[model samples]
Target: MRRMYFIFLMLCSGLALAQPRIQLSPPQAVVDSVFFTETTTVRLELDYPGVALRYTLDGSPVGSNSSVYKGPLALSQSATVSAKAFHPDFEDSPQVSIAVRSLKYNQPLSITNATPKPAPQYTGAGLSALTDRQKGALNFAATPKAWLGWETDTLRMQLNAPEAGKVNMLVFSLLDNAGAWIMPPAVVKVYDAGEQIGQFETARPEPGGPTQYHFLEVPLKPWSSDTLEVLVLARQLPDWHDGAGRPAWIFLDEILLTQKP
Candidate 1:
């Protein structure tokens, strides 16, 4: 009986090693690198006509009971996405794995000095609109939007602290609509108790791969303060880009705060 078991195991290993490997449509997809906002709907595609695709989101191995790839996966939280191709003639394609992180943040209690022209359409109760856990995606603007628009080059806002604590980072989410001429802020400066604490700059458009939505995370040394002020200044569009000379509209949302653990 022992000899038979050993012989069976050796045959199975040999058969597994002979299977053909499967590939994904987008080569950029990899493990632990891709990040998506919670509102993002990611579509996975492969060109293998005869091969069926099976996927799992809870770190489980794909089986006959697993989900079949039919449409885009909506990521509402962090998850490990794994998938593979199957065909009767070919061995199971090597599984592709990736970690998709859902973006969620805790924002400031109140914001002052926004003065966003076309005031935030949905300001609930007070100035806590930006951080109200509401968010907007690429389209379907107006309602259920977490964005505030300031048709200017500069925006200054004061933040009220949740409690006395040490903070080291500030994250701002902005929109870049090339058609609408909405651009990103180039400089971010932080002030604590009326004195400038730190300032950071972001790189402009890359040679390629400029994103429609941009997130700016500025790091600051650990500082204790009850209130912090932020200034966002944007550079005007060059003659080459569209909507030049007019005020560079800046849309902002999610003033996330990060503190050292």
Candidate 2:
């Protein structure tokens, strides 16, 4: 009887040791703005003591061996900052990330000549809305007026610079919500005086994911022009999607021009 009782006690001890470890809460990142002109500072905060915070700046996953966060990070260029919290007594916290854009925000410009205009219901603030520097929320239903959507295959716009400079990049703020049947553009082409200057082909997303925002960057060959043209081509819903073979919905909130330094 005593031997049986000892075996039972050993099993109980093993069960106790096998209990799942508590998960540590993730660290919170505080920043003044996600968009900056020259430099931006990111501060990470965690209230829990005896926990170490690790971080990465190049969009890589934050591992236990990643750089320990000692202080605020001063970023001079665009990057995705990711972080996590670790404690010896707990499982590592889920990763948290934030994207920062380094660009000359609100560069003086006039937007006009939109062909195959945005759907009337989602016209947003009209042509000027593209350059308003206002990013759209992930929930299109919540901020319907912030986005200009298109059900068609093509969208073209003319951007006129009052005091033009050499532009090296074009950033398009877009939304991707597969459940809602909204997808990002397939191709983005830029032109100057009807001559193609730059082109970008976006990668196709997998079949399922939650709604999210994406910044599509198109790199140009460092050229300047008073008048520039942008063309956006919509992707057709893939066979795996519910609306297969039909034109996918496209949403655009803001367009940013990044100048060459």
Candidate 3:
């Protein structure tokens, strides 16, 4: 009987030794990199072979028959990724953790406080041609209304800059008869005395409203005294020909040129 009891004890010991062992490779959790996208993944390598790997998120079991993670595991947010190994004996591995971060537009500045210096004077010929309706519509009460509405219905303005520096800024206020600011493609030429310095094509115009102000910044070599010649012509509407519809009219209240002080 003693011999039989000893044999039985030995058999139980052997069975316990035969049971599968489950362990994590690193023992402690690890992540490849801290900064990762929502699509980034974490890899949990298993140490024991032939054993099923089970996982949990937070604290919930991932479920039986869950795909064995042979490679990196996918994670969307910053959270703990825990896993365990399952064998017939129900051995389990330790849990793990991984951190993640989110991916953002930067907007530009708005134009305000634009005024013309050394104001312009309106020529009598230009002023006399204005119809009673045009004179009544004049917004700038100040003189040198260098701007004039011609018999051809074209409006012209002559401008000048007194100080030298890069012509880094251009600001203009225009009135649209359509009650909306219309940006017509136009060319702006810069001249120092009689010499041409630079030119830029106006592409983006401010949105039309009761009063539209446009601010354009150009980078050019520094200069002190320059005359700006701006010729603005109305563009035909996509489906309508010129002269068939109301003429495109823009009233200039001010044009400001500025540079870094």
Better of 1 and 2 by lDDT: 2
The collision pairs in model 2 are none
Please provide, for model 1 over 182-234, each residue's C-alpha lDDT reduced to its tens digit, 9 standing for 90 to 100. Answer: 67777889888777776878666432232355556677655567777888887
Per-residue alpha-carbon lDDT of candidate 3 for residues 1-261, written as tens digits (9 for 90 to 100) = 999999999999999998877543322334553333345566665565566666654535555655566667666553456565655644454444333221101011222211221113323223222211112122333323433321222333445454446446544433333333233324445445556555556553323222322323333455555445444444332223233333343444334454422
Query: For model 2, where is the 10-residue window of minimal lDDT?
Result: 161-170
Which one wins on TM-score? 2
What are the lDDT figures for the candidates, one per model? 0.62, 0.82, 0.42
TM-score of each: 0.57, 0.75, 0.32
Best candidate according to lDDT: 2
Off by over 4 Å in 1: 1-108, 116-126, 140-144, 206-211
Residue 135's lDDT in candidate 3: 22
Off by over 4 Å in 2: 1-30, 38-52, 70-76, 85-95, 162-165, 207-210, 222-225
Q: Give the per-residue lDDT of model 2 (tens digit) for 1-261.
A: 999999999999999999999999878887766677789899999989899999999779999799999999998887788899999999999887767777754466667788888888898878777777666666777777779888988888888865555557778888888887899989999887778878999887786554667778887764456888989899989889989988888898878877644
In model 1, residue pairs whose N, Cα or C atoms come closer than 3 Å (at least 3 residues apart or on different chains), thus clashing, are none
List candidate 3 segments past 4 Å from native: 1-157, 177-185, 203-213, 216-220, 224-226, 240-247
TM-score of 3: 0.32
Error of model 3, residue 245, in angstroms: 7.9
